[model samples]
Target: MKLEMLDTSIFIAYVVGLLIIALWISRNEKAEGRNTEDYFLASKSLPWWAIGASLIASNISAEQIIGMSGSGYALGLAIASYEWMAAITLIIVGKYLLPIFLKNGIFTMPQYLEQRFDSRVKTTLALFWIAVYIFVNLTAVLWLGGLAIQTVAGVDWMFGMIFLAVFSIAYSLYGGLKAVAYTDILQVVLLVFGGLLLSYLALVEVSDGQGFIAGFSVLTHELPGHFDMILSPDNENYMNLPGISVLVGGLWVMNISYWGFNQYIIQRALAAKDLKEAQKGIAFAAYLKLLMPVIVVLPGIAAVILYPQLTSPDQAYPSMMELMPVGIKGLVFAALVAAIVSSLASMTNSISTIFTMDIYRPLQPNKSQNHYVHIGRIATLVALGLALITAQPLLGQFDQAFQYIQEFTGVFTPGITVIFLMGMFWKRTTSQGALSAAIGSAIFSFALKFTFPDLPFMDRIGLVFLLCLALTVVVSILTASKEGDESSNQSVSLDEVSFATDRGFNLAAIGCVIILTFFYVTWW
Candidate 1:
């Protein structure tokens, strides 16, 4: 399904224009002299809209576009629980978590950990995140993105991967977070437009040009099983979604770990102009999450009917793109590229941040801010290089990269979630306890995996989270009693930090919930 000349021209124009915008945004940073704060946090000036756009841009990359669409082809709409559930999770994070982070003025998650616990915990998790971002996250994004281009435009996969990596670094390397966040607005718009366009075309084809609504009706009427919001135990895809547990169990812990504590995702909110704007951005992202399934998932479901002979589920999205006309195909292809590179930029930026702020800066305390910023840039390059080298080797075997990523990350999310949840709300939690939970998370998850092979991964994560939470509490109590320091070791003053939101935010949250309820109820 090679793209036509017009399509190629449109995609090239988009790429060139995006690079210009990014370079322009970052043009003044070097002249003004770079600093860690300016480069890493965008000088703390992101408004709600940029922050919101960047959040979605950074999140819905190759995994959501290609991988989850593959899951949609295989697992049905049950896969959409990840996006739909994340809408509610974003609200919870905005209301409960962003306030604390804003009040603390922390640059990185590890820095927050250091404030609440100690350097040991900060360094440990910082190292862990760097490794995961480079190996698991960065590689997966690059691999799936390269695969997307190969499938859609008949481009060489290696060429596509290198182009994405180079393009991301070219736009983002100098301008830093500012370049990434602002350009992300364009990226999100393109991705949404492209995604919706693809979905609409797919539906129209499904209805034999009867139109989107008619096509949607035909799909729901014909493939009723694909419309199920909650998969029953007997459903083959139940292991991935795990039915009602997606709403009530381990998925919540997963969502909290991702939306709340993840460095790249939360970094956007942390860069907001103020707490109010950050919360607003978060609320804005929640609505976007509600829209994501329509853009990313529907095309895959349509693929089931349109191109049932696809060799792999991941091919669903690209296969659908073949249905687009010339110029539209270019625009949507550019949108897919936008989603991929934005995330690559975002992830690399955070990797640099965690490395520079949490690890390197601490060791070289007397280094100039410029030197730290330089180190951060270097770290970004290094991380991306590692990912490029390892992307294929790491993710080549996975048929559904989205589910593989979820399962791989699920093992560690429980501990990370427990540490953050207990650290923020429970003053009694000690550094040792947090560290124990972090380490025990992997041990418990692996043990459960081998011992109870039949248990759904989602349920396993939920149980492991509870176990980690209990471990943190018990270890905190015992350690405190042994040390004869019963009072809280947490340095942050939570009493002074307010979690209250403006009325607009409250209304937006209610709207998000209402929309999600409508989706689930209608689908269920």
Candidate 2:
């Protein structure tokens, strides 16, 4: 049970690197007139490729790299369903979902919902997403990043928490969307490289005289059913209670909302130079998603083969890092730091946007734009503080770091995804429909969460997702769009974004879907 934790040298180097990067990003954000638009949407100048890479990196974070892989280890092959499903989701977003978004020149997903449905719907989904990303996802994000920092860098968690909060707020608040997007591009590169290094190291450990296959032979003999698609219900394997259905369903619901609808993530794509470039960004991310299992998941599987007696799956990932070859330790540490900072920076920017645009600016319509920008910065700092404090209770609380976060996200995602979808394409969808889906999904998820708390609540995302969809459709059909508002418009243009890059991106996206489908059938 007692093992060498982590080298303090590696941890220290990572923190130092993080500081240098954060300061560098802050400098870039200060370019003249980059104020409002620059801070919010990266001045809408982010090319599709930058937005795409950033989108993937921002979405991956510590949760996907560390936590999700931990789940892959715990659940075996079933957890991989998330990545597989996510690829398809992006395709749908690119083809069916995006035209509506880009066409309206919408700033936030909520804004589009407001115009198509009602302001009340916009506010409701906006508030729900805020709670999920900020209160729930944001807390875990900081905590996990802090945990990684503490393990690799040597700062105590309380201090680590503060360090993450301060650095994340400093630049994200200062740079706005521009900082987050560009930094995301940087983070994605680091994350992918880290994944490659980690996989190579793991493969080397397993290989013997012949190399990879020889090394892989050890796992086959050591961990029976390590590759099992169906895990026992009583066991920790992903197939346990939620089963393959939830695996498929949970992933379907989450990715659709995450890639297609979530504002913070989508905003990156929205800033693309053209539709083609936007598509490229998304396809690039999908390609990366396919590779993640090899990086994040395989390690966990290898950990089980190598360190089977650890007695806890959560220990699997950290155990691998502690045992990695010394020369490569620094790279892993650097990559981990990148993941943490990228996520922290993202959430900080998004929460600040919500506070300023959704709540404050509306309330104070007469305020100078300059004054509003100042207020946005202040709100970012406050959010960082709250997130840090919120993360405090989570410290050392959950045995499995990732699941704790997913369960929380599942509750809010169902409602947010439902309302956003209805409000976007369905003109007949009324405020009443949006309200019901949001309120209904939240109430239903809450009830189920309490009634079956320890169960794989991923089904919770699906349950309310289905319900909200049903309610939205039924309500829209029943009440209809306001008499004069026109409920029957069905053609949303593919060129809604009107940017230069999107068409090429669409071609790339189609190619990605083809590749992903091949994988799905083969994997299936």
Candidate 3:
């Protein structure tokens, strides 16, 4: 599937134009010299739209587009619970979590932990995150993205990886998060438009030139099982998306940890001008999440009828792109690249932030702000270099790298979630308790998995989360000082933080819930 010259030209122009715009957006900071705030937090000045767009752009990477599409082909719409549930999660974060983070005026998630708990808890999680980001996350994105480029554009996989790495660094290393966030608006716009166009064309094929509604009708009638929002216990894919557990079980723990506590994802909200602006941006992102399935998942469902002979489910998305015209193919390819590079830039920026602010700055606390910013840029380059060197060796051998990554991360997510939730709301939560939860997450997760070989992973995560929570509570109670000093400086001052939302935000939350309910009711 060699790209026509016109398609190749469109892709090249998109790449060049994005580089120009990203550099241009950050030119003032480059000329004037960036401080730690400017380089890492975007100078605390992101508007609602940029925050919203950047959040989605940074989130929907090659792994998601390709992986979720694969799930759509294999497990059907039940996999969409991840995205749809995340919309509600964003709203909860905005209403409850963002107020605490913004009130503290912190730079990173680890910084917040340090404020709420102790240095031991903060440093432990910080190191864990940095290691995972560099080894697991960065490598997976580059490898999966490279494979995607090879499939869609007929490029060599090695070249595709290098190109993505170089492109991400070119625009982002100099200007940092400000560059990444501002440029992400364009990336997200292209992603939405190109994805929607591809989906529309796919549906048209299913309808044999009939319109979208008719095509949708044909699909519903022919593939009724594919439309199930919740799987039955007897279904073969039940382990992947357990029947009712997605709504009430470990999935909530996973979503809260990712949306509320993850550095790369939450950095967008942290950079906003105020809590209200951040809340608005979060609400905006919630709506975009609601639309993601149509773009990323529907094409795979349509592919069941369009390309039945695909050797692997992951091939469904790129296989469907064969329906596009030449010019349209270029636009779609550019959109795919947009998703990849945006996520790369966002991840690298966050890695630099955690290292520079949480780890390096504490060790070298006397350094000037400019010096710290310089260190951040260097850290970004170093992390990207490491990922590039190790991408293939780390991920190339795995037939299901994305699933493996999720399972590995799941081991730690429950403990992490317990730490954050308890630290935020429970004044009795001690530093020792928090630290125990961090270590116990992995221990409890693995212990349960081996003990109950037949237990569904989602149910295991839910059970592990409960065990971690109990461990934290019991430890905190036993370790509390007689004079109350144990919980004194370590707890968030909830009285000083306000969780009140404006009328518009309340309305948006209601709308999101209503829409999600309609989706489940219709599909079920």
Which pairs of residues collide in model 3? Answer: none
- lDDT tens readout by residue for model 2, 1-524: 11123544655555566556656776766656645566777766777668667777777777777777677667665566677667767777776676667666666777666666666766776776676666666777787776666665566767867777776665566667776777676677777887777766675676643566665667656655665544556655542326655446665777787788876788887777655666666777777777777777778877766667865566566567765666467667667767777777777677677767776777788887677778878877777777777876753577666777666666667777777666655556666777788778778888877887665667667777888889878877776635345652332223343334455566766676687666545444
Error of 2 at 6 (Å): 14
Clash count, one per candidate: 0, 21, 0
Instruction: State the displacement of the C-alpha of residue 160, model 2, in Å, after optimal TM-score superposition.
Output: 1.9
Number of the predicted model whose TM-score against the real structure is largest: 1
Residue 218 CA displacement from its true place in model 2, Å: 3.0
Off by over 4 Å in 2: 1-29, 208-210, 229-248, 447-456, 481-484, 488-524
| CA error at residue 477 for candidate 2, angstroms | 3.9
Better of 1 and 3 by lDDT: 1
| Native-structure RMSD, model 2 | 3.8
Instruction: For candidate 3, write residues 437-498 as lDDT tens digits.
Output: 98889999899889987788888889999999999998888788742565646337788899
Error of 3 at 52 (Å): 0.6
- 2 or 3, which is superior by TM-score? 3
TM-score of each: 0.98, 0.87, 0.98
